[model samples]
Target: MKPVRFQFKLKYLAILALAALLLGNRGFRSLVRNYREYSRLKSEKAQLEQQRVDLEKKLAEISKKPAIEQAARTELGLIRPDETEYRFPAPKESDK
Candidate 1:
């Protein structure tokens, strides 16, 4: 009977160790996943910051008088009162 009792305790200890190992493995996997997500978000933040700077520069340029007039002349097709507009026909593709 004493031998049987020792065998039972040993089995229980083995099961406990296995359970601890499985739980630790799961926790380690979660840590690795979180670290990858953190790195991805950090890089995305840098890309967004660069885009924001580029947009700010564009905004500053568009706010200027020359840029506004250029947009009006090209996009809106407006010309000065003293200026005459000319339209040229496209050359034939065969000419190229």
Candidate 2:
């Protein structure tokens, strides 16, 4: 009976020690932190990859002459020599 009690106590002690080591070890904490950081970085990398793909597609579109002219006219307010440009005032906002 004493040996059985000792074995049970030893098992409990081992479980407690393992729990303490897992919860208190610096390396284990760092590993958890690093895993979270790696996950966040992976998500950021995916977002950057998507952004790069979008930029590449935009670059391909703007590589064409017609797209270039459209971008210039829209972004730079440029008009062709034979075309007339018009400006309009913004509509007034009513007070609440």
Highest TM-score model number: 2
Q: Residue 92 in candidate 2 has what lDDT? A: 69
Scored against the true structure, residue 38 in model 2 reaches a CA lDDT of 100
Clash count per candidate: 0, 0
Please provide, for model 1 over 1-96, each residue's C-alpha lDDT reduced to its tens digit, 9 standing for 90 to 100: 579989999999999999888777978779889999999999999999999999999999999999999999999999999999999989999988
Identify the runs in model 1 with alpha carbons over 4 angstroms from their true place.
1-24, 93-96
lDDT of 2 by residue, 17-96 (tens): 99999998999999999999999999999999999999999999999999999999989999999989888877768732
Query: Which residue pairs of candidate 1 clash?
Result: none
Model 2 TM-score is: 0.71
Which residue runs does candidate 2 get wrong by more than 4 Å? 1-15, 88-96
Per-residue lDDT, model 2, residue 61, is 96
